[model samples]
Target: MAKILVVDDAKFMRMTLKNILTNGEHDVIGEASNGKEAVELYKELAPDLVTMDITMPEMNGMDALNEIVASSDDARVIMCSAMGQQKMVVEAIEQGAKDFIVKPFDEARVLEAVARVLR
Candidate 1:
């Protein structure tokens, strides 16, 4: 199990993610509503993994993903967005996201992505 940061604008999504990760025995170090908060908390918590949502009120996840990667090459980020565009996924990978997961999160997929990134 890894320390994880869950970033999403939706409260329910964050809570749901928390439940799943906790069940998987991973400690959720922190949660962020947007990419900006994600970055700031990222610096503070420095979790083993970050699950980020794409669209938000301020500072989208991709930009935050880039920022985090720029700040720390060791940062392991998993993009969790509703966006299924091939270009977006490719760009996220190019920008240093370790993995991608679609929203309306599946417990299996989420855990699988986390495990893959942590590996």
Candidate 2:
């Protein structure tokens, strides 16, 4: 099982991600309300992976992914996006995100992405 961090501005979204990750047998080590908080938590927790929302207050997923990967070359981040944000998702992948799960995420897809990244 991998240790993970869930980062999203919406409390419900964070809860959803938490449920999914936990059900997948991963330990959610921390939660963050924004990208800035995610970066700090990343430093503190060093989770095996992070599920980061693309749009958030203070900072966005791209910036957060950049920050985390910069600090740890092996940091794994998966961008969570809305339907129309495919371009942003691509940018995130190019920026070092391991994968992405579009919002209102599918449980299987979330698990698949997490598994792929872990492998």
Model 1: colliding residue pairs = none
Which digits, one per residue and each the tens of the lDDT, describe model 1 over residues 1-119? 69999999999999999999999999999999999999999999999999988887799999999999999979999988685565787899998999998878899998998998898
Q: Which parts of model 2 have CA positions greater than 4 angstroms off?
A: none
Q: How many backbone clashes can be found in candidate 1? A: 0
Task: Please report, as a residue range, the 10-residue window in candidate 1 with the lowest summed lDDT.
Answer: 81-90
Candidate with best lDDT: 2
Q: Summarize candidate 2's per-residue lDDT along 25-114 as a digit string, tens digits.
A: 999999999999999999999999999999999998889999999999899999999999999988999999999999998999999999
Identify the candidate with maximal TM-score.
Answer: 2
Q: Over all chains combined, what TM-score does candidate 1 have?
A: 0.95
TM-score of each model, in listed order: 0.95, 0.98
